[model samples]
Target: CHYCTFVTVPGKLRRAGHGMFLSPDEVLAIAREGAAMGCKEALFTLGDRPEDRWPEAREWLEAEGYDDTLAYVRAMAIRVLEETGLLPHLNPGVMTWTDLQRLKPVAPSMGMMLETTATRLWSEPGGPHHGSPDKEPAVRLRVLEDAGRSNVPFTTGILIGIGESYEERADSLFELRKTARAYHGIQEVIVQNFRAKPDTAMRGMPDAELEELAAAIAVARHILGPSARI
Candidate 1:
């Protein structure tokens, strides 16, 4: 059975009071429940260092007895392992080598979506990753490199239909393949199609067509080969 739980935290892209801010105990309790209900994995998805961008996030972390979001996540991950025995898969956005090392012990795996390697998205006004510093392709690639150096099994992939050209999508897949070959630590590549939400910045963007998604998957399979899971 595959069951999962998400631990939400403030993100750089989110406005103040955007989501629930959970305490360590609260997070642990959720993990325990998930375990009791037969969950095998817990995904800790947090904003990439919300404290750096939002004063409210920083104050909340400090008041909660954590120096930073990663510290809080580390403690919660340890608790999830020790108390519930679920393998934690962290998707806490961009991370450094030191951050990966710190949480690697408790987490069996971690992930971040490369989204796309196109720099134009960053420069484009109202682009998907516009204003989201942590969403930079170079920074995300560096995180993948760091994860490889740390020998951590990682999950990464591309987000299609986010204002990227077909060529850009291919480029993204190729970059992932190169990184995976170099590190041999990439466990899976998730080929996710973007779904625009009603309240988000990309609300008006059309979803990728079925044929486009199929083509993207075919490209990923060809580049990453049989060993890669897409």
Candidate 2:
């Protein structure tokens, strides 16, 4: 439904609501609605920022007294899922070792896909999220190493087309592969196409073509080796 909401024709059915940002009761209600439709596994993606793409939406929630931090979001997710007996049906993204430890027991083996948006998007010298790749790599390695200590399986992916070059894409894959080699936990790679959403700096920019995405995936598979999945 989330997919259809965005990609549908004429934008006839938009996913506009405060429910997506706040209101645990509303979120739980939607989860129940999904379950009733035979969705055995409910997958809810909690965005890293409330308004990283839609600042107005995020601000609205803040005005209404919503906690926008990842920690609060995770706690709310766990709360609603448990309250409605949907805990077994939930899967949340863990960004760091601390988050992994916190959510693993609640949603064991849940995906902890390492986020790399800043790595690529911020590569430009003046990019808003800019940080050195040199520093980025160590953070990634620590995430992988900590995932190993937890004795749990996981999956990871990358956000592409953030004004990064093809070489940078390949380099990102190489770094991910290096981490996977040491941890042996990362099992899948999702190469996400960046969307130029409203209220974001990248709005109106073209999204990546299918061929570019395929090529990147192919290169990623090669870099990750035959044993590792991409």
Candidate 3:
């Protein structure tokens, strides 16, 4: 997303494709160490589908005998579970029913940030989500429903700031509540505030104030209720 400041290798570095992923053995070794350090859950928060964006990602996957990043993640999740005895919580972005089903056996939970349901941010030019296809509200809501249908414990939430109005924030929480009420698979909802970074596309955007976060959290509580973990 345009507002994101997460460390990622895009464009030139992605095209260069010089780096390689650690082998499964190496990943398991780290997980095992984490388990020794009393970490019971191995959280995997990955960038969405880099292979779809860069051919280098595809080439790297092919070199490793995987067709896509999701399959690689599933395989790694299985390895983490079997070798390290750490429960895996995946956040591989928007996923389909089949993808959820495939990852469910190894992953106890998964998450994807809903951000907001405002189509304006996604459809209008110069908006935070305009060029980001995975940030599409319909697609994200579909993922939520699919996770519910699959009986997977899921985490999701609305992001405050980023130019969405209070109404859009409320609507996003309500959408989450609707899915939670239907399938009871939602484990938690996070109310996150945007913290723009100097290096990001949203560097000039104002940071979300405490008032906005408090308001959003209050509304989330009202919509999702006291029983809901927010």
lDDT values for all models = 0.84, 0.58, 0.88
Model 2 residue 222 CA deviation in Å:
2.0
lDDT of 2 by residue, 21-57 (tens): 5466767787788667766544556544435446565
lDDT ranking, best first: 3, 1, 2
**Model 3 Cα lDDT, one tens digit per residue, 10-62:** 56454776354556877788898899999999988778888887777888899
Worst 10 residues of 1 by lDDT: 1-10
**Alpha-carbon TM-score of each model against the true structure:** 0.89, 0.65, 0.93
Model 1 agreement with the true structure over 1-230: per-residue lDDT tens digits: 00012323346225554533676777888888999899999989876787887787888888878999999888888888888899999999889889998999989999998989998787677676777677778999999999998999999999888889999999999999989999899999999887766545567778888888999999899988988899
RMSD of 3: 2.1
- Backbone clash tally (model 1): 0
Runs in model 3 lying further than 4 Å from the true structure: 10-22
